[model samples]
Target: MSYLIKPAGYQALLDLQQTEMGIKRIKDFFQQNLSSELKLRRVTAPLFVLKGMGINDDLNGVERAVNFPIKDMQDASAEIVHSLAKWKRLTLADYYINEGYGIYTDMNAIRADEELGNLHSLYVDQWDWERVMTPKDRNVEFLKKVVNRIYSAMVRTEYLVYEAFPVITPVLPEEITFLHAEELLQRYPGLTAKEREDSAAKEFGAVFIIGIGCKLSSGEPHDGRAPDYDDWITETENGYRGLNGDLIVWNPVLQRSVELSSMGIRVDREALLEQLRISGQESRQELYFHKRLLAGELPQSIGGGIGQSRLCMFYLRKGHIGEIQAAIWPQEMRLEAEKNGMPLI
Candidate 1:
């Protein structure tokens, strides 16, 4: 029921200058820590992609993408990406990346219709990563292992951030709890998914609400995630929840795993076909990426996105998202935040 609960003790700690410095330090530290932990390589990612390639994340199956006309190319619109979910997978396959190694890229996107709030933003930024996987490592256990590694990287990043910005102390909950969507539903049949997450997170301090895509007993997915990357059944849940009922969910949480590199035993030709049929996206086979996937040309990989802004915000312990990033804010919202003593950075 609480979409936005304004925080008390309103004070913006970092000025624009300190905020900038803190942002850079946080980013630099996270990059170093994550790359080292996951054995990931930093690569360049595109700001836009060719539409209809099925490479773009259709967030919630509805949000509009910022578009521009490609000069001298008739009728070809270059869409600013919402996120590079499918692209990274294809990149691993096309680039012939080896197993046990993956790529991380700075991904920036424009979401035209994002609801302006303390957290939501029109401009998106994250570390999108993907890597090759073998047929053997696609299961709940592997997913849990990967999640733990990612959390460790986060904790390490927090430590590094505190080193530079001693004033910012983020007491990240030590252990991350994992729970299935069904289990959450069973626990709180009356609560909505977000409400369940809030309750569970409040109790557990951190949680990864897993098993997206499949309908619950309520006949709806606890959240929506695209069909292609994660094998819904095998992938367990992951995410952090803060003490004040804040969910660790960020970036395109359910819609696109922040690091969208889910390379579980690449669905064999048969399983792939079955999934395609079930998702009603067999038509995707016509796309370049889908074709390669069907033909077994791509490598098996598991990857995900790590929200840069979310990480920065988490480290800074800022209440609203605007405190950490320089992005557009409406006058009314700015005024309201200003009244609360939280200035826009």
Candidate 2:
């Protein structure tokens, strides 16, 4: 069954027509501002990659990847990308990209297993980015610095959005709150990780939730991430605090944060092996690309995917994600949104 959210009188926030224009202006402003700030050169990305290349992100190792047979390559299959996290790292290594700079690409994909909802569809699109870094750059301070740059970019984008559409009340904060996942669990032992993110972000206006993938003090992943990318202990998960002090967690299940991105420090050789052992995905070591990586064939890098639609949704503040993009939705959800005066694009 599909899920619904209480609009909290958010129904009349923006008229439908202005919302559309705001989405366009906001996207343009951020792309220009972020590209300038990050020194990112935009590149074209693929929707599907050859299977067995170790390029596709296996989210939590269980989500199904949409795949199709390759007509030209005998016995080969191509799968729609889940994210560019792994692929970007490989690209950096293969290209011998220099340290302290990177690239961003428009990545589009299909997530067939995504449960239908106000926030999710089989369709996915994002800005996938990665950069080469020195060994010394792979530390908490560096990561936090990068996150701050990103947050600053977001804030700048928000300002431009407001300038274009004054109706937006500047829901995003100027600074981001930072914390470890374990600390959050300690702060709210009874609440789930989602609840913890919500509470913390609500308090800080913007927050970076750290320590993903590995088991929290509660003995479960604060949330599942592919064990290959982010280092759980050192890495922090990030999200924006909402005006309501609610965690802007994308309720993909309920059409919330819309998870515009999943980014992290790419695993180094040793961390890669350790993560493999911990997740019992050692069998993957035999995969073609995995074997090369295990043999230290890949380069050290960091990367992630930022959801295009999710960013649009955040700036627009529309109740349902459908307002900004075209995608399939369950029948009941369509009717429910209409009943609440929400329009699907």
Highest-scoring model, lDDT:
2
- Regions of model 1 farther than 4 Å from truth: 1-5, 233-276
lDDT of every model, 2 decimals: 0.68, 0.69
* Model 2, position 47: C-alpha lDDT score: 82
Give the alpha carbon lDDT tens digit for every residue of 1-345 in model 2. 557674755564577677777777877877776677666777777788888877788877888898989877885899888887777777776777788778888888888888765567678877788877777776666766777777787788778777877777677777777676667888877987767776765566566665567676567867776656765544422332110011133332233333445566777777777778888888777776677777887776666667778787777676666877888887778888888766666
Cα lDDT tens digits, model 1, 1-345, are: 112335666566667787788889888877888888888888889999988877787655667788888888886888899888778888887687888988899999888888777667777788888778777775666666777787787778778877877876656577677777778899977988877876776666556665665566787777665566555533323332110111253322122112212222234455556656767778877887777777888777677677788777666766667777778888777777878766876
The 10-residue segment with the lowest total lDDT in model 1: 238-247
Give the top-scoring candidate (TM-score).
Answer: 2
lDDT, model 1, position 44: 88
lDDT assessment of candidate 1: 0.68
**On a 0 to 1 TM-score scale, where does candidate 2 land against the true structure?**
0.90
